[model samples]
Target: MRVLVVMGSKSDFHIAEKVTGILDEFGIDYDVEVASAHRNPKRVEELAKKDYEVFIAIAGLSATLPGVIASYTTKPVIGVPVSAKLRGLDALFSIAQMPPGVPVAAVGIDNGKNAALLAIEILALKDESLKKKLEEYRERMRS
Candidate 1:
């Protein structure tokens, strides 16, 4: 299984790295893309069609990338709100307050690591190896 990590801008790549770094720790396969819900909506639409188990969309400001991605696919989308102006709260609300149907699980401001963990947990639901890995990860956290 693979996860797709998309960001609204190239500048958000730094935050996205925190996600990929944790995925690497768990040996999860993933791909990253720089696409914006406003500036590059078409790219986001197309990428959503690609094969992937989960998506993590990172954005700041009027963060609409996560919502846009959620609109195109039924797969789980986790949002990481980058700490831009408004300290990312605007983004957090934009993502968390998505309308009734289009759901996007949002993490804390600039908390890409949690976004990654959430995605991994979703994938582990049907992946035995990943499930075992996550169990070990929890054990480590408890130690």
Candidate 2:
């Protein structure tokens, strides 16, 4: 798969659906998994080790999933902060304020679509067809 979409809990699946919808439209290969960094650190670590070009981690209320995953692998990680608490600011800060060395790209709160688009952009670096598709998508957006 080109992308791996991981949610911290089953409740976040709704947001994940937004991500998958965009990926589907772009015909990108992806797999979804529900694993929490707090509850299942080992599983999160394992998932990070998998072979994927990009990762989209959706979490809220101390969203540590993205940073944790970024620590495990050098691949790009896009963090989607769900609006679970504190208007999702807590999650947003947690994701955006990653310590220097380990970085996770943070999207807007509950913005899975942008996260998916960012992943596509990352993948497009090495994929000419995807680059063309992304250009077409942007043109459509401009209309």
Candidate 3:
């Protein structure tokens, strides 16, 4: 399975790096891009239509990236609320409080690791090897 990671700004690269590391650990393929819902709405809409099983959108402040992405595609979109001004609460609510129909799964503030894990879980649905990897990972966690 392939995942698309979109960040609202270049400053969010650190968070994206953590996500990519987790994806790499799971041997999942992914593409990362820097696009903004507010600054580059066209790019966000365009990328959302690409061939990807899941999408992880990282943004702070208004945090419109995830919602915009969800609007354009039916694919699962995970929102990572980056910690910016107001301690990321604004971003968290912006992602979590989506209107009906368009849904973006929102993770905790600055928690890209969980976002990647969630995407892996979704992809593992049809992949036995990935499911085994997740089970092993979970067993390790319990150890």
- Superposed Cα RMSD, model 2: 0.5
Candidate order, TM-score descending:
2, 3, 1
Model 3 lDDT per residue over 26-100, tens place: 999999999999999999999999999999999999999999999999999999999998999999999999999
* Model 1 lDDT per residue over 86-129, tens place: 88889999989999999999999999999999999999999999
Q: Model 1: what TM-score?
A: 0.97
Highest-scoring model, TM-score:
2
| Candidates 2 and 3, the one with greater TM-score | 2
Comparison by lDDT, 1 against 3, better one: 3
Q: lDDT at 58 for candidate 1?
A: 97
Tens-digit per-residue lDDT, 1-143, candidate 2: 99999999999999999999999999999999999999999999999999999999999999999999999999999999999989999999999999999999999999999999999999999999999999999999999
Error (Å) of candidate 1 at residue 2 is 1.2
Clashing residue pairs in candidate 3 are none
How many pairs in model 2 have backbone atoms within 3 A of each other, for residues 3 or more apart or on separate chains, i.e. clashes? Answer: 0
Where does model 1 exceed 4 Å of error? none
RMSD of each: 0.9, 0.5, 0.7
Top-scoring candidate (lDDT): 2
Q: Alpha-carbon error at 28 in model 3, in Å?
A: 0.3
